[model samples]
Target: MTRIQSHPVLGNTSERLRVPFYFDENLYEGYESETIAAALLANGVRMLRVHEESGTPRGLYCNIGHCMECRVTVNGESSVRACLTTIENNMKIYSGQQLPNPVKRMVEQE
Candidate 1:
């Protein structure tokens, strides 16, 4: 599936910049102003991440960045809100399954 060609309210999306980006190492095109979630949806990629604890499949919910459901890893960073991050050319997106390692504080033996 391709991006929305035309909408009743917002028409003529051709003017927007169509840049290529990588989602899970796969290349896909996305508009400049489009968010990461929008870009993924355009390429028929609904499942972006999974719940860390339950391992449940997840995707876009609130596209306003308020919800963390759309969280994805942009480049090397993790827990980035897909709805808030705009797509850029050659941006490498990830599912954020392997989150950043937490800082471990070494404790003295009691």
Candidate 2:
């Protein structure tokens, strides 16, 4: 998917540097200074994590780092906020885990 063509409030995102990052082993690029969740959403990735008990998929909710729905693993660190975490070059992000355990994806029925 393509990045945001132009943001009404932010103007043009093309001015920022396109940082390369890995999400679930897939290569994606996002503008510099943009949050990890923002980048992922722009690239059409909605599922960010899974519930520990229910095994349900979770994505961006309160993008201000309060909802705790966008938690993801960053560089081996667990429970990192995707909405507040900045996207860095060569960063690795992974979902599908409830803390340390891999849970079923949101699309799965069983």
Candidate 3:
């Protein structure tokens, strides 16, 4: 189920190799060098993260990097724009983790 078992356009998506990673404390299997958003989407992770203002869920709105709707925090960096970032082995992504302490303090201070 980790690999693309079925697809309309790119039938039976093939990958170079499978790699393990964590997203917000959840372990996920994906291929190396693939976009994190692509791997998440392939595994039915529709909501990458939420908007700060409206709390609206968002995902790969654009496959390319232009839309910025698929923003996520990879390894503590916020607003990573997932569609543009490729997945790496043992990548500890923080898509749904609580905001960083500094950012939380900054927000509270504001």
Per-candidate TM equals 0.81, 0.81, 0.73
Q: Write the per-residue lDDT of candidate 2 for residues 1-110, one digit (tens) a residue.
A: 56667888877876778899999999998888989998999889999988977778888888998889998899889889999999999999998575433344544646
Error at 109, model 3, angstroms: 12
Q: Rank the candidates by lDDT, best first.
A: 2, 1, 3
* lDDT of each residue in 15-106, candidate 1, tens digit only: 76778999888999888788888888988999989887566889988888787998888888989999889898899999957333334223
- Which candidate would rank higher by TM-score, 2 or 3? 2
TM-score of model number 1: 0.81
lDDT of 2 at 19: 92
Give the whole-model CA lDDT for all candidates, comma-separated. Answer: 0.82, 0.86, 0.74
lDDT of 3 by residue, 22-109 (tens): 7878888877667898888767788887766556676678778898787787887878877878898888887543334666678999
- Candidate scoring better on TM-score of 1 and 2: 2
Per-residue lDDT, model 2, residue 57, is: 86
Q: Best candidate, TM-score-wise?
A: 2
Candidate 1, superposed: residue stretches over 4 Å from native? 8-10, 98-110
Task: Indicate which candidate wins on lDDT.
Answer: 2
Higher-ranked by lDDT: 1 or 3 = 1
